[model samples]
Target: MRLADVVLPDSAVCSAAVDVAETYASPALLNHSFRSYTWAAAYGTAQGLAFDPELLFVAALLHDIGLVAEFDSHTVPFEVAGGSVAWVFAAGAGWSRDRRRRVSEVVVRHMGTEVDPAQDPEGFLLARATGVDITGRNVDDFPAGFRAEVLQRYPRLGLVEEFVRCFEDQAKRKPDSSAAAAIGNDLAARMARNPLERPE
Candidate 1:
């Protein structure tokens, strides 16, 4: 689906989320976050699943906020740190307690291997989209033309190399965190072969 055709919620909450994420994350990281949202939205549409656009948008944009140095919690996994930040953002926007909790859950669980959409649709889609963007996993489910369309709107801008560096930095700082565990299992080889890191 085209970025324009994709309907995002328009409100103070959504706008504030964009502002906060853009302020904290690097440009490459911001673009990745936006792409993750679009990919997840597309997947939801294809699967005939209903999702809360506002929550999904907020969760996706801020999923990696903890990777930003200012938000990092030295002892926690980056996802947990990011989730904490998201909870505050959502709460400040007057989200109900349950809504804010879902926001936190979605951000914290995005790195999981599998999540049931029926139970946690936001987390499930966020993980799936992030996986597709970061590792090119399940990318074939999206038509080549549409994938190109999305990329044109939000280019990777060397996101693969940038994100790998961010993950590596986090892992080194918190060796027992999930980021450290993903290094050899989920990230290492894919980052080495990532197309975004290829010479132009």
Candidate 2:
């Protein structure tokens, strides 16, 4: 499906969102980001959550959309730059108060270690999902909150198989760079622990 089709609540604002995300994200990194988000939505679905895939997907796609404006004329790190852009985009887009707040929270806190799973389930889930997709292990080395449900819903072996396939697909499509190399390494490690030979 088209990138636009995957992200929703379409508007001029959303179009700007894409442009914003593209500013600091290398083509490859952007693909990785999308893949990570897609995996999260899939995992959430497997766990029986009625998540808005399109909304979550778009949110994931544009989580770093703020980087555009921040890095345009500054030398700050992309994370900091992206956070500033996020605030601007949220305001310019006329995002609902809650969405603006959540988007801002996601951008600013994405790289931190201060996450509180009990207090912010969605944030926790997003962080965990990003970790798994990027590093093949949940941050803090914790098990997924919905691990049992995911396994029960899809069977242990099936879940492993699905994740393997998703990882492989992401690896193949990932843009080349240091970040992609890291993701590749993580995927390899995950695969070694749970091998799933692809179909011929």
Candidate 3:
């Protein structure tokens, strides 16, 4: 299916989420957020994975807010901070307490190595999509043409270097953070080698 076939949510919460993300996120980060949701939604559609599109859209868009100066936390990991931001955003959007919690959980779990699809389809889809975007892992799972369409809509810009630098800064401050783990595993080199950076 083409990118247009992947129906996206356009609710009030989704609109507000775009506003907040645009206000805080850099151009590249904002594009990355958009691409994350696009990838997740498209992948989910391809796999027939049941998910909440509105919640996934909000969580995916705001998942990296903690990396921005306005929301960055000095103590907690970026994902934790992002999760908190999602919680508050959801509350403001008039979501139920449980709905707010689920969005927060999806945001926090986006960084997971593997989120169980049966347990949390949104989380699982986000993790898979981010993995594809960031490290090019499972890049071959989706149709090549669909992937190209998504990238055309939301180009990577300078996401590779910028994201690596953000993670490095986080690692410097929080050695116990997941950023540290990613760095310790040589994330920079991995990012450098991401296939998306290469020509088709």
Which pairs, if any, clash in model 1?
none
User: 36-130, model 1: which lDDT tens digit per residue?
Assistant: 99999989988888888899999999999999989988889999999999999988999999999999999999988889999988899999999
lDDT of 2 by residue, 123-166 (tens): 55566666654445542232343333232332323334444453
Task: Tell me the tens digit of each residue's lDDT in model 3 across 58-150.
Answer: 999999999999899999999999999999999999999999999999999998787999999999989888888888888887777877888
After superposing all C-alphas onto the true structure, candidate 2 shows an RMSD in angstroms of: 10.1
| C-alpha positional error of residue 143 in candidate 3 after TM-score superposition, expressed in Å | 2.0
Residue 98 lDDT in candidate 1: 96
Report lDDT per candidate: 0.86, 0.49, 0.90
RMSD of 1: 2.0
Question: Predictions ranked by TM-score, top down?
Answer: 3, 1, 2
State the displacement of the C-alpha of residue 29, model 1, in Å, after optimal TM-score superposition.
Answer: 0.3
Cand. 3 TM to true fold: 0.97
Of the candidates numbered 1 and 3, which has the greater lDDT value?
3
Model 3 lDDT, residue 21, Cα:
91
Clashes of each: 0, 3, 0
Model 3 misplacement above 4 A? none
